[model samples]
Target: MYKILIVEDQEKIRNELGELLRRYGYEVVIIEEFENVLEDIKKAEAHLILLDINLPVYDGYYICKEIRQTLDTPIIIVTSRDSDMDELMSMNLGADDFVTKPYNTQILLARISVLLKRAYAGYQEVVQFNNFKINFSKGILINDGQEVELTKNEMKILACLTKDKGCIVSREDLVSYLWDSEWFVDDNTLTVNINRLRKKFESIGVENVIQTKRGQGYFIE
Candidate 1:
């Protein structure tokens, strides 16, 4: 089943859209925090997204661009802003489709169906971020023209951080991922790996990408 993330802030619209999608046999994840909409979508591992333009912390255009940089998750702008500029901005930011608010249910569903097919059929192999192209399949991080090798653990850590790019990744979650991969290690080991990862980033002429969140976790700055 395809996962559909609803990033709309209006309670009624969000719920209604979710219900509509759910009825069509799509699993829906509703957004509860407008301030962290993009993070929520990433964590959900959603197949497609219905994003709103007028959000609390960041607008849809900003979120769209950020997601496009790292992921190719199909985004359909479901917003009340129907101006030409709004539509143009949505397209310019890499949105797959646009649906104006008070949308006709059928048209919305059709657009989503098309985008989902396109997305699942072909997805980006490299996640682009800050002049770096991270290739997970080959365990390589490329910057400019240089290629930096990453160990299995380092690759996993980088994957986790890049997956949650603009948001914090809790230490607990990172540890859990490692455990799930049958590579159990102490917290100290994770720290050492993180430091090494930072050094690799530095070698690539990048800095401050992996940020420590004090008692929380880590995030890409």
Candidate 2:
């Protein structure tokens, strides 16, 4: 799922936007504190940002400029400011799109879809871990001129684990991401797949990449 960070200060509108996005299957993150918004955005690792012009300390345009300095994350200016200058300024500061207040739900979703598709085209199909590179499209792990093929489940599991890098991913979450219906998949199935991934990595002289967090879950460092 794609994660979207909302930098709106109004309580009612923020909550409403979050609910709407969640209903449409997008992960929603709201920014409550504005003092360190830029730092928060950095930690969010969100695929996109929903920004409001009227904020607490720093306005959306300033924040947008700061973000553009370091991040390419798509930003959509959603504010009550409907003037042409407002939209033009947003665009000049590197915002991907602009939308006025009381936006049509369907239109906002469509814009988000288009921006996400355009922004993430050909993104993250291959990731590096340690000295090896894992290719998701080909389902192979390569290192030192040697290649090791991975099974469907193994590839999915590895991809999920590597998505957050050092974060511990719960077993239930992993199961949910791997299978359509978690009810039909058992814990042993995931354990078996993880074991297979470990063996595959070991075959290519990589070890201890996937670590278990006892009762919590697993993580790759």
lDDT of each: 0.77, 0.84
lDDT of 2 at 98: 99
Error of 2 at 160 (Å): 20
Best by the lDDT measure: 2
- What C-alpha root-mean-square deviation, in Å, does candidate 2 show against the real structure? 15.4
Please provide TM-scores, in order, for all candidate models, with all chains considered together.
0.55, 0.60
- With a 3 Å backbone cut-off (N, CA, C), the pairs that clash in candidate 1 are none
lDDT tens readout by residue for model 1, 18-80 = 899999999899987876676776667577788999888998899998876544467899888
Clashes of 1: 0
lDDT (C-alpha) at residue 192 in model 2: 72
Residue 29 displacement (Å), model 1: 0.3
Question: What's the distance in Å from true for residue 3, model 1?
Answer: 0.3
Separately for all candidates shown, the number of backbone clashes (residues 3 or more apart, or on different chains) is 0, 0
Best-matching candidate per TM-score = 2
